[model samples]
Target: MSSFFSRLKQGLSRSRDSLAQLVPGGSVDALSEEEWLDIEDGLIMADCGGELSGSLVQQARKRRGSSIEALKTSMLSMIPDAKEINTSENGPFVLLVVGVNGTGKTTTIGKLATMFGQQGKSVLVGAGDTFRAAAVDQLAVWVERAGADMVRQHDGADPASVAFDTVQRGVARNYDVVIVDTAGRVQTDRGLMDELAKVRRVISKAFPGAPHEVWQVVDGGTGQNAVVQVEKFREVAGTTGLIVTKLDGSGKGGIVLQLSHTYGLPIRYVGVGETLEDLMPFNAEAFITSLLPEHAVKS
Candidate 1:
């Protein structure tokens, strides 16, 4: 646990720095109205979003004890949903992942496969980002690292077809889990989103009740724009959860809480670096402590 906490703090150092610029010393005592306003804006800048930031301020104003602790409880209370992967009812639990390029979609999949593989689950990966030959190669590398098999097609092959083939293979082999990766679809474009819809449809056609989870990956560095991306992807893919990446590279890790607070959807995982093990489950306590060290548990 301490090792994970150390990683969490190291991963969130950039965001902590960004937040420190707002509160300076991380103090919450006798703040002037102007200082309070700066704090609120600072949180929004950290990608906490305006609504959640305002709510935090309101709660802090009335707290009888530590303002930072009160803020922690307030944020924790907003996590109304936390999803756990369960494979009891199905032979191969399917996970469909979508995101823009460079959001670390492939890495996220690889990390998940590694984690599941460590649990002794047989995993199969579908390289559905067929437009880019490099995407398949990248996925192939991670698949190898995770000790999982991959189903891939030549570049320019239909992504939906790859999804279908992967599921069929997983079913035949009775694999524990099958994860599919799709091409990066620009959320604002109708045609691109429509293509994603088609991929989802084909997955359903191949196996009903498959693709049990559709997770949208977002680059947390993009801040509030990540929120818009999630909203759009959810509309197209019925995104069941989120995987936020690039936290170590961006000062916007707070977007996790903002998304959880706004959509109440589960944040399944987050990536802090390029390594397969850099991706970790979203621990609410660790996240809050990393961002607001004043609230961290005393040794």
Candidate 2:
């Protein structure tokens, strides 16, 4: 296996082991009613929502074949195909990223810069999360490591202004891509959500149709809560995609399925480890293979 796939398998070991223990050893045709229930329960235990787990179990039961193959088919059908970010616009491609605090939002931005840098694209990052001084400092460190430029203001400065400046600078400097980071706020805070909306508007004003994409970074280990974050952020920021993080050693990998089933938004990337290269572009086949037995697809 390639290094990324190997790391993904290792990262999902906990979730995979939990699922393997629940799957019946023999063929699906021989599965008892209790065994069918066991499969559903296992999915729930892995943080796939109860409704989705039931639906997947029902679909799998209808497909009579190898147990692992049938279950994998059911899951792959639920998740949409992975898609790359749209960066083909005329000027610099701008991306606005938002999420709750402690979800590794800033770290994800840093990794994004590194990824774009490796592509031979110049990256300019905006430290829009000005409420926290540490966030700015942390992003600065990541920007330098990635060899990317950044625009920031003092702590407590207007985040929208910072975003505006970043986009303006990106245009002026002719950077290939500009990524703007937002303050992590609770989903329930209407004021904060309004502020986030303003940031998006300012980015657009700075560059028409800018912020080509708004991606939300979510913690895979947060289970069902991740769903709520996506919903709220999508409402205010018009989130275009997702970047899931903290999957390493997090047995809750099934949350990815739940999110996909819930929103149907493209999963742009997944963070399986702490290293810069651990952020792998979403691969549907590889994800399923890592999370379950690598049985051939049943016709």
Q: Whose TM-score is greatest here?
A: 2
lDDT of 1: 0.83
lDDT of each: 0.83, 0.88
lDDT winner: 2
Which portions of model 2 miss their true places by more than 4 Å?
A: 293-299
Which residue pairs come into collision in candidate 1? none
Model 2, 1-299: lDDT tens digits are 59888998988888888887787666788888988888888889888889999999899988977778888899999998756667746789999999999999999999999989999999999999998999999999999999999999988999999999999999989999999999997999999999999999999999998888999999999988999999989889998899999887577888988998789988888988888878888887788789884542232
**What is model 1's C-alpha RMSD?**
2.9
Which run of 10 residues does model 2 get worst, by summed lDDT? 290-299
Whole-model alpha-carbon lDDT for candidate 2: 0.88
TM-score of each: 0.93, 0.96
lDDT of 1 by residue, 132-231 (tens): 8887898898889889999998889988889999988998899999999999888898988998998899888777887799988999888878889988
